[model samples]
Target: MRVGCPKEIKNHEYRVGLTPGAVREYVAHGHEVLIESAAGAGIGADDSAYIAAGARIVGSAKEIFEKSDMVVKVKEPQPQEWAQLREGQILYTYLHLAPDPEQTNGLLASGVTAIAYETVTDDRGGLPLLAPMSEVAGRLAIQAGATALQKANGGRGILLGGVPGAIPAKVAIIGGGVVGLHAAKMAVGLGADVTIIDRSLPRLRQLDDIFNGRVHTRYSTIGDLEEEVFAADLVIGAVLIPGAAAPKLVSREMLSGMKKGAVIVDVAIDQGGCFETSHATTHSEPTYEVDGIIHYCVANMPGAVPITSAHALNNATLQHGLALADRGLRAIAEDKHLRNGLNVHKGRITNHAVADALGHEVHAPENLLYVA
Candidate 1:
């Protein structure tokens, strides 16, 4: 199989879909690898390194997209890239289609087999491919929120970890999943007073045990979240609904009750955000004020640290990627977990969550592909 990778073109996106090390693995597996020139520049891997790993360096993204049987990418295809897709070609990347009807339409029109990394499940029912980036995004949320809280950055001028005789900032994380857990780790480590709210009592108990009473955990309720949001200095929106649109936990009216100059880092912004006022921001201009509350809603927070995130992502994706490269649709037919990754195949939505979110009927991949 011929696998190709193109450089990410999103705003301030520096992660390459295929690393030099990852290319070497593909090469070792007897797969031909093509990488567009400077595709690895974000992670400091140049053309020479790819060449050293036995990957042919292509001159342009156009060539990579046009020639490769399977296109591996870090972000979803942009508008121009979408037009280049064709029937029978495979697109392996993060496709947050629940929120973006345009992208979903583009994939359908292109007749491409699109497998979304974010929706891929493990045997344990965990989203394996999305975990690495989630971990990165979670950790970055606190860092970005802390910076946004500085007075010059349009925040409340409060130090996250207050000094002696000064009260520490209150952080309310609206999920107890991977993102919320890591965000709490960073927030608590920085000496902030942290509270995590979630709908799952079992998960809340797990979080409480993990934190060992260092941070607060609350059962999610309308009143519970509102009370926490109103009292918090920094709010991290970390909720997720798998491939579906994220539930908006905080409304615009609720923002009026929040502390003035407080910061909100919506880690769920890629899935359409858990905050009513949230809009996808770029690292170039990461924050904006809504009702005097600072919002840091960078959609690609992991893209800010490509070196760490790219390697981490590649680590999680390599095995499944190799399975696809080796057997293509047969791998999806054989592995239920990998089949869950199939969002679109041959002009149809195959993932139930994505289909329901986009108001389309689900076409199970098993029906779409012949089982070997």
Candidate 2:
């Protein structure tokens, strides 16, 4: 199998799909690897490094897209990139198609087999492929919110940790999943008063035990949500619903109840944000003010730290990628986890969550792939 990676072209997105080490792994698997020139530039791996890893460096993204049997990427294909896709080529990447009908249409029109990393599941029912980036984005949420809370950034001019004579800034995190847990870790580390709201009582109890009462864990109810969000100086939107678009937990009217100058870091922005006001922003322009509330909803929050995120992502994706490279469609048929990752295949939506979100008919992956 010939696998290819192209340089990411998203706004301020610096993460690479394949790193030198990952390329070496593919080479070790007896597969030919093609990396577009400077594809690994964001992760500081130059052409020489890829060459040393036994990867052939191609001159253009178009060449990589045209020749590779399977295209491995960090982010979803941009308009131009998606336009280049053709039938039979495998597109293994993060396809947040639930919120973007245009991209979904593009994939369908191209007749490409699209396997979304975000929907890939583990035996434990966890999103294994999305976990690494989620962890990175979760931690970055606190950092971004803290910066946005500065007075110069149109925030309330309060320090997140606060001084001995001053009160600490309050942080409300909605969700007790990987993102929320990591956000709470960072916020609490900064000495901010933190509260995590979730509908799962068992998960809330687990978090309370983990934090040992350091951070408040509240049951997510309308009154509780309003009280916590309104009182908080920073609110981190960390909710997720697998391949589906994130539920809009914070409405436009609710913004009026939040504290003026409050910061909202929607870590769920990739799946459309939990905040009603969120539209994808780039790192170049990360925050926008809405009703006196600051929204930091950069769609690719993990891209801000490409080195760490790229390596972490590579680690999680390595095994599944190897499976695809070795057996192609057969890999998906054999592995249920990888099959769950199949969002679109041969012009049809294969993932139920994505199909429902986009109002498309779902093609059963079982019907599409022959395990035998």
Candidate 3:
């Protein structure tokens, strides 16, 4: 199998798909690895590193996409790269297709095997590939929110950790999953009064046990969320619905209830955001004011720290990449968890979540991979 790694082209996106170490492993397994020139440079990896790992450096994106049996990437393919996609080639990446009708249509027209990393599940029902980036985004959300809270940034000019004898900032985190948990950890560590709200009691109990009363856990309800947000200095929207778009838990009306100049870091912006006002922003223009509330809704928050994000993402995605390369898509189709990752195959929407998201008919991956 020939695998291709392309440099991310999204604005402010610096993470690369594969590292030299991953290239070496695939090469050692008797597979060919083609890396686009300067693909790893954004992640602090160079062509020489890939060459040392036995990878062939390709000059153009066209050659890499045209020659590879499988195309691995970090973000979804942009409009230019979308034209390069071919039928039967496998695309393994974070395809957030729910929000973008154009990307959904593009993948369908390309007739490729599209396996979304965000939807891929582990045996424990955890999103393995998405977790690493979620952890990074979660931690970064606090930092970004803190910066946005500064007076110059249109915030209340209150310090998160606060000074001696001053009141600490209050943080409200929506959801209790990986992203929410990490945000809570970071906020609490900074001495901010933290409150995590979730629908699951078990999850809230787990958070309670983990934090040992340092952070408050609330049974998530409309009233409870309203009360928390009304008093919050920073609100982090971290809700996710697997391959589907994120639920809008915070409405535009809710914004008026928050303190003036409070910041909202919607980490789920990639999944269409949980905040009603969030539009995908770039790192260069990461925040905007909505009713006196600041919104940090960068679609690729982890991309701000490419070196760390690339290595962390590579660590989680490498095993799955090897599985698809060694055993081919058929083996992945046979595995139930891996099969769930198949959003599109042969021009049909194979995942129900993605299908429902775009209002298309869902084709079972098994039906697409093998004839009955």
Candidate 4:
């Protein structure tokens, strides 16, 4: 199988799909790997590194895309790259289709076999591929929110970890999953009072056990979230719905009630945001003010730290890539877990969640592919 690694082209995106080590692994398995020039430069892996690992360096993304049977990427394809996709080509990437109708339509039109990394599940029902980036984004959520809280950034001028005789900031995290857990851990480490809300009591109980009373957990209702928002110094919207649009838990009215200078870092912005006022921002211009609240809604939060993000992501995704490459889609079509990653195959929406989100009929990949 011929695999291509293209440099991420989204605005402010610097994470590459594959690393030199990943290339070496594929080459060791007798698969041909083509890396576009400078693809790994963001992660500090030069073309020479990939060449040293037995990868062929290509001149352009067009060459990589056109030549490879499978294309691995960190983000969804942009408009220009979408045109390069051909029927029967395999795209393995973080395709957050629920949030973008344009991307969904483009992939449907291209007839590529799209396997979304974010939707792939492990045996325990956790999103395997999405977890790594979520961990990165969750940690960065606090960092960004704290920075935005500085008076220079139009915040309340209060420190996250207040000095003696000064009150510490109140952080309300809206979800108890990976993102919220990491955010709470960071906030609590910084001595800020942290509260995390979720719909799962069992999960909340687990959080309680893990944090040992260091972090507060609450059952999230609109009223509960509204009250928390009003009192919060930093509000981190970390809600996720797995291959679907994030539920808008924080409404515009809720934002108006939030304290002035409160910073909101919506970690789920890539899934269409849990905050009503949230819009995708770039790392270059990461924040905007709405109703006296600061919003840090950078869609690709991990991209801000490409070196760490790329390596972490590749660690999680490489084995799956190899599985898909070695076994081909026919074998994957037989595995229920891998089939769940299939978003679009042969111009049809193969994932029910994506189909429902886009108002299209779902085609089971098993039905689309012939059994050996």
Candidate 5:
């Protein structure tokens, strides 16, 4: 099998799909790797490094898309890249298709077999492939929110960790999953007043034990969410619904009730956002004011630290990627967890969550592959 990796072209996105080490692993598996020129530049790997790893350096992304049996990428294909996708070719990447109708339509029109990393599951019912980036984004949310809280950034001019005799900023995290847990860790470490709201009582109890009373774990309710969010100096939207769009927990009316100059870092912006006012921003311009509340909704928050993001992402995805390269659709047919990652295959939506979210026709991956 020939696997191709093209340079990521999203705004300020520098992470590549495969590292030289990952390429070497593919070579060891008897797979030919084609990396587009400068594909690994984000992670500081050069063409010479890929060559040493037994990967051929292709001149352009066009050649890679045209020739490779499977295309590996860090982010979803942009308009031009999706245009190059051919029928029967495999695309393994993060396809947040629920919120992006344009991208969904493009993939369907291209007739490509698209496996989304975000929807991939593990036996523990955890999103293994999305965990690494979620961890990065979760930690980064605190940093970004802190910066946005500065007076110059249209925030309330309060320090996250207040000095003696000063009150610390209140941080409300709207989920208790991987992103929320890490965000809580960062906020608590900085001496902020942290409260995590979730509907899962058992998970809340687990978090309460983990924090040992340092962090407040609240049962999420409409009233509780309103109170916590309104009182918070910084609110981190970390809620997720797998392949579906994130629920809008903070509405526009609710934002108006929040403290003036409050900051909201929607870590769930990639799956649409938990804040009603949230819109995807780039690192160059990460925050905007909505109803006097600052919103830092960078869709690719992990991309801000490409070195860590790329290596972490590659570590989580390499094994599944190798499986696909070695056996193609047969890998998905055999692994139920990997099959959950199939969002689109041969012009049909394969994931139920994604299909329901986007109102698209659903097709079972096994049916499409004729696996039986």
Candidate 6:
């Protein structure tokens, strides 16, 4: 099997699909690995490092896309990269297809077998591949929200953890999942008053136990959400719906009711955001004002810390990627969790959530793969 990794070309995205260590694993499995020149530069691995790991360094991304049987990447293929995809080629990456119609349509048109890391599941019904980046994004949300709350950034001139005489800033997180939990940890660690709201009572109880009653847990409701949003200095939108678009919990009308200069960090922006006003921003200009509310909606927040993000992502994805390299579609047919990762295979949408989200016809993985 031939596996290829091209440099990530998204705005300010630096995480590569495979690390040198990951490449070494593939090579050891009798698979030939090809990496674009300096593909691992974001993670501080040079061409020489990949060469030492038994991966051949290709001169250009074109060469990699043209020659490899499977194209492994960190982010979704850009227009040019998708254009280069051909029938029967496998694209293993985080394709947040529910949000981006253009990319989804392109993949369908290309006839490529697209496996999305974000949709991949574990035996525990958890998104294993998406967890590492979610953890990073959740922690970074607090840091980014704190910065966005500064007066110079057009936010209320309030510190997250106030001084002896001042009141601490209030933080309201709108989910109790992986991202919300990590955000709560960061916010609470800074002595900020934190509240997490979720619909799942069991999850809320778990959070209460984990936080040891330090952070407030609330049952999510329209009235409760409004009250929390209107009162908080910072609101973190951390809701998710697996492979579907994030439910818009905060509407434009609600923003006007929020405190003037308040900050909102939509950690769910990758899945089309839980806040209605969020448009994907880059690290260079991470925040924008909407109805007097500041929004931090960087789609690739983990990319801001590529070194840790790359290693963590590779650790989670390497095994599944290796399975695909070793046995192609058969690996997905054999593993139900891996089969869930199949968003588009051979021009059909195979993931129900994604198909419904995008208003496309859904094809069962079993039917598509001709599994008995």
Candidate 4 residue lDDT tens string, 1-372? 999999889988999999899889999888999999998888899999999999999999999989999999999999999889989789999999998999988988999989999988889999889999999999999999999999999998889989899999999999999999888889999999999999999999999998999988899887887888899999999899888888888889877788899999999998899898999999989999999999999999999899999999999999889988887887577677788888888889888877787788988787898756
Task: List pairs with backbone clashes in candidate 2.
Answer: none
lDDT of candidate 1 vs native?
0.94
Candidate 6 residue 218 Cα shift, in angstroms, is: 0.5
Model 1 Cα shift for residue 338 (angstroms)? 0.9
Candidate 6: tens digits of C-alpha lDDT, residues 164-213: 99999999999999999999999999989999999999999999999999
Q: Score each candidate by Cα lDDT.
A: 0.94, 0.94, 0.92, 0.91, 0.95, 0.95
Q: Using lDDT as the measure, name the better of candidate 1 and candidate 4.
A: 1
Residue 189 in candidate 3 has what lDDT? 87
Per-residue lDDT for 115-187 in model 5, tens only? 9999999999999999999999999999999999999989999999999999999999999999999999999
User: Across residues 1-372, which tens digit of lDDT does each residue of candidate 3 receive?
Assistant: 999998788998999999998998899889999999999988788899999999999999999889999999999999888778888799999999988879999988988888899999999999999999999999999999999999999999989999899999999999999999999989988999999999999999999999999999998889999999999999999999999989999999999989999999999999899999999999899999999999999999999999999999999999889989988876676688779888988889988877888899998887778722
Clashes of each: 0, 0, 0, 0, 0, 0
After superposition, which runs of candidate 1 have C-alpha atoms over 4 Å from their true positions?
none
lDDT of 1 by residue, 9-111 (tens): 9999999888899899999999999999999999999999999999999999999988999999989899999999999898999999999999999999999
RMSD of 2: 0.9
Looking at candidate 5, what is the lDDT of residue 272? 94
Q: Where's the lowest-lDDT run of ten residues in candidate 3?
A: 363-372
lDDT of 2 by residue, 49-81 (tens): 999999999999999999999999999999999
TM-score of 6: 0.99
lDDT of 3 at 277: 94
TM-scores for all candidates: the values are 0.99, 0.99, 0.98, 0.98, 0.99, 0.99
